[model samples]
Target: MSWNIFEKLKTVFMKVTQILVKLFKKTNKSTSLTPVSNVIATPTAHYEGVQTATIIAIPTNIAKAVVNCCLKNRIDLAEAIFRGFGYGNTKIVVTEKEIIAETSSGIVLLDPSKYRLSEL
Candidate 1:
């Protein structure tokens, strides 16, 4: 038993910290086995208008406070009072019947005919 240089630098620093904690636990168990490997599974709702683009999860400041409370209660009564409160979630809720143009540069437009709620 004759080691010493501080036990050969503490056995090469415990075999380089056990090979860096087994390479960070095998890269966190291969990233928890592909938790949605590329993650793009949430599409399928495109009818464009009378509402149906819901993909909610909630929090883009509570979905822009439910799209500014359905754009202040009258864009078709806030598009029938915005409702897409989560069921799968990736954040989407487009109810477009918008058509409010008044653009010289003051910019106030929508689409489908027009919507100008006095250029909010």
Candidate 2:
């Protein structure tokens, strides 16, 4: 029926308008603080050493151990270790074979099997 069609159209329009409003709100908030180009440029350049990548699945227990090691030690120390591996500004990628950290200098790969999380 025409009435059902109208109701569906109305629902679709309202949903679209809501989505636009939310998007605009986010855009306005971001634009107000700094130029969009500057905001975009800084993080990418500063964190260039950090990159994200997918790899073979890592075991859950190994992932937990790495996290525990970082938590048990000061987070800063964990950062330092990553930096030593040459991943100073990069996001780490974990894999079955090793954990990879990127630095401005080059790639650092660490064996998960070798890593043992020390207790605090």
Candidate 3:
């Protein structure tokens, strides 16, 4: 009789422990799944007569979008549209202001003033 009671108590205890463990696991997963912000601030250096700083921090997706837009549209049209979209690419530069990229055409300024850098 006492043995039967002990078995029942043990089963209940094990089930409660499992439930607690599952709850803790779920809580941990939920915390880990929280989204992270994407904003980045890169150090800038000033120079005279055609700034020659290398842009190594532009996001890959933004660069791809600029390249794709340039490839898909005429230079003037792409420039107009991308400028409206807050970015543009040419033979020399991708985007303007802060100078995010450069090409064989020459050095181009990736201007952060044109658009929100955080969005990029």
Over 53-74, each residue of candidate 1 has an lDDT whose tens digit, in order, gives: 4332222222333334445543
Taking all chains together, the TM-score of candidate 1 against the true structure is: 0.20
Question: Could you arrange the candidates by lDDT from highest to lowest?
Answer: 2, 3, 1
> What ranges in model 2 sit over 4 Å off?
1-89, 118-120
Q: Over the full model, what C-alpha lDDT does candidate 3 score relative to the true structure?
A: 0.35
**Cα miss at 64, model 3 (Å)?**
0.7
| Candidate 1, residue 7: how far the Cα is off, in Å | 69
- Model 3, range 9-109, lDDT digits (tens) per residue? 33433344345446657775333111223223334333333323343223334444344333334233223222223312211224333334433232334
Q: Rank the candidates by TM-score, best first.
A: 2, 3, 1
| C-alpha RMSD by candidate, in order | 25.2, 19.3, 25.1
lDDT by residue (tens digit), candidate 2, 63-82: 43444444443343223223
lDDT of 2: 0.36
As for model 2, its CA RMSD to the true structure in angstroms is 19.3
